[model samples]
Target: MDSPNSARYSSRRSGETSRRHRWLGGCRDANPDNRSNVRASSQNIMSATLHTRESFDHSPVMAEEIVALFGEVPHGVVIDATLGGAGHTTRLLEAYPWMSVLGIDQDDMAIEHAAALRANSADIAQRLDVQRGRFDSIDTFLAQRNIDSISGALFDLGVSSPQLDMADRGFSYRQDGPLDMRMDTNAQLSAADVVTGYEVQQLTDVLRNNADERFAFRIAKAIVAARPIANTTQLAEIVANAIPAPARRTGGHPAKRTFQAIRIEVNKELDILPRALHDAIRATAPGGRVAVLSYHSGEDRIVKQAFRDAESNPLVQTVASPFQHHQSANKLVRKVKVAERPSAREIELNPRASSARLRVIEKVGS
Candidate 1:
């Protein structure tokens, strides 16, 4: 879930402006076929923001399926790991009257909005426990409340629509903004640090590892050469020039991959995911589940491996029942993989949902 950047064009790219668009030139592909699926997701997000007493229905990807998955689990508190606007949280609460949500997010804006939403109704306030924190530290949050086990956990990975639409937050290259793509406003590391500070090799790795950009090395070199990038618009221009013109004609935007990579790095989105998923699995009741909606290849890979390991690794322990006891034996888990793009309509309506992959694991034994 990510940002903006700015770097002046290098000598090789100085003259190519006339050949591109008036605004960011080739950066904003004029071809309708090249409209970015991921960026287009913001439109769906905006549409989904229908306000309700339960919470804002932020058009959570696969909300119905998520609710159904939790329906069979032992009814209790479910962790909304990435609680952007409490879309899934409120949905779950409404789905099962007995269900409650432990909502968490690092973004101050999201937390404040939820607080206001809760204040308007005492029911929401009692049913939802909003916390300002990262999902990777789920264990600590649970232990602090003396909570030992959960019914299920849901992680909708990636930046939310609100984060992307706010250009000042620096999650989009479509608008000109400072290089500050931090999910948590308080995080010391920002996109500014990433674009201006990272060395070529490190930047290249970030690009390739985070977004699978084919021109990682070339982009890294171009960015380094055009140092002191000031804003997202400037960064977009540099990235567009770094790639071959032919390639730019096809992708929705030349800077999408780079912006995503930098945002991932600034937030360390992948670093703590494995541990968080494992912890969520460990604390779940035998019949409970951990569901993840990963938006990119890197996140999906981590979720797949963590669940697979829990099923096969005997050393992995789990809570035996409720909050009563724990066991050291193998934690048996059944993996449930949903169909690729199960929601064709969802994808057509919300382009960003196209890349979303849902993975679920139900704990059967310990």
Candidate 2:
């Protein structure tokens, strides 16, 4: 993967530009991919405006699978842990008119959007509770509200559209925004800090371990030389410039893996995911279900392992029911099902759905 900067000469070639754009377009078809591009194209739009009607046309990943895990609508509260843009929340409210939702997000902007969404819908307005906090603190948040044991919970993990689309968030290398990629803008750490402050080896390890970037060492060397990266475009450019010409075009984007590594580090996303899933499972009542939609291998690994561990406990039993119907409460899905991707039709409509994978577990043994 040639860093965009290193290959600026080649990138300008008509053929190279076309190939890059085509690859980008393929990735963009998924909502997750769109968010990456939105992060890259952040300069033109406000973060709040980044997620307008046009950006939200695609359905969420595995909507039916999630609904099935949730089973027939139960008469209790449910949590949407990540609650990005409230897509899943909207569906839940529609499917189960009686259910109340506690939609939580680390990002204040997401909270704002969810609140507005609820306000616009009379039914959701009455049933929704929006909180601005990390999902890892879900138990504490619920306790504060005098609520315990929700009937269901959902986690749509990873960057939301508006976060990437808005350049100020600095999540995408493609978009030129301040190198600040904090999911919670209030957080002190930012992508700029990583690019400018970390040691070469440290940065290399981050790219290699977190993102599996093959050219981690070279990219790290380039980034160290281009210190004090002020914004997304410059950092991405530096990374792109680092790769040898032969190695540059190997991957779709020379900076894709490096950017992913930096963003994950900036947000502390992987670090907290396992803990959040475990806590979510514990927070729900026995018979309650927790469904997670992960967009990448890193996120899916944590969800898969956590659910697997839960099923091994004597307290948790396997749900033996057929796939389409609801399984008994107190029983979880027996195995980690294949990672489900967006349908071809869905991918066409919302390119961002491509990388999505959904997994679920139900609490048993009261």
Candidate 3:
């Protein structure tokens, strides 16, 4: 989830290295002896060492579910598309002795952190190979690696916990920082450019499309009026002040959606997501799986549509309109019915997991 970076909009879209070659370090197993433990059914599935955050302390959302989702795939290289802190990758490596992971992330911090993490264990260090780049560029990555396809891929979308916790990243509206929200620190576009550059309509569209901000127009207008908006706090204040008082009181923060919109614009998150998903689907071997853990409506809708598009023949979908529930019969991919919500206990333990939504599809044949 390349989101706002924290509990709210943890969606950060930054730019950096066109390619981060490898960050194959590891995490010390928190539960070394109990890596294979699993509780009852999926109701509250928990893996002893698998669910806890890595030494990096960033927990992966729906860890148990992620493992189970990929468990059925043909054992081979699985792509951890958003390898923030490598929590899910570590879990997957521990759970599936036969599997290796090709982790990908644009954030240098995540890649560096993962590199250092793998140093703790040679097992994962040997199995995990990380690359720094937008996940959507999967095609280029596979070509460079001399790999033809993958067994599975996982997309955990959003800004990472560390990104939000650190005020310098400018992802938290509650804190004051420079208006920078590029997931890749090296990326050219920054939140500052978006806040000060986009016109009212462009900005409004971004707000509406990225985060579905109801006060998109008002917020955009207010932002334009407050030209030299200084930093995150000021932007947050302006956004809050522009919203009707009643609406301000409900959402956790009036600026959450605004920040999300800006981050998405800065990173071009929505624009490239479809290509990324489709690329992953295309690169998947027969019986392989592609799983996504999106954090918001916009991300979810795109994931749903992409999966539907893969499942349905384009010619047949035109007729699907008359029958809204029309089921498409195809052989390329099939949905994996999964209960993806965070368990109440999981939410209680990590509130950031509240908005996580996981979707999975399996490649049926070539």
Candidate number achieving the greatest TM-score relative to the actual structure: 3
Select the stronger candidate by lDDT from 1 and 3.
Answer: 3
Scored by CA lDDT, what does every candidate get?
Answer: 0.70, 0.66, 0.72
Q: Write the per-residue lDDT of candidate 3 for residues 196-229, one digit (tens) a residue.
A: 8889999999999999888999999999999887
| Runs off by more than 4 Å, candidate 1 | 1-57, 314-340
- lDDT rank order: 3, 1, 2
Q: If ranked by TM-score, best first, what sequence of candidates would result?
A: 3, 1, 2
RMSD of candidates 1 onward, in order: 11.3, 9.5, 7.2
- Candidate 2 Cα misplacement greater than 4 A, ranges: 1-58, 317-333
Residue 36, model 3: Cα distance from true site in angstroms: 5.6
Task: Report residue 362 deviation for candidate 2 (angstroms).
Answer: 1.5
Q: Candidate 3 — which residues are off by over 4 angstroms?
A: 1-5, 8-55, 313-339
Model 2, span 275-338: residue lDDT tens: 8888877877776777777776677777778878887764543332216334444444444356
TM-score of each: 0.80, 0.80, 0.83
lDDT score for candidate 1 against the true structure = 0.70
Candidate 1 residue-wise lDDT, 1-366, digit = tens: 222221111012233332111111111112244233323323322222222312212356666567667877898889999887666665576557677788899988768766755665565677789889999889999999888899989888878765775678888899888999999989999999989999999999999999889999999999999999999999999999999999988767889889989988999998989999989988888778788878778878888788778867543323312222333333332233432333786655445566777777667654
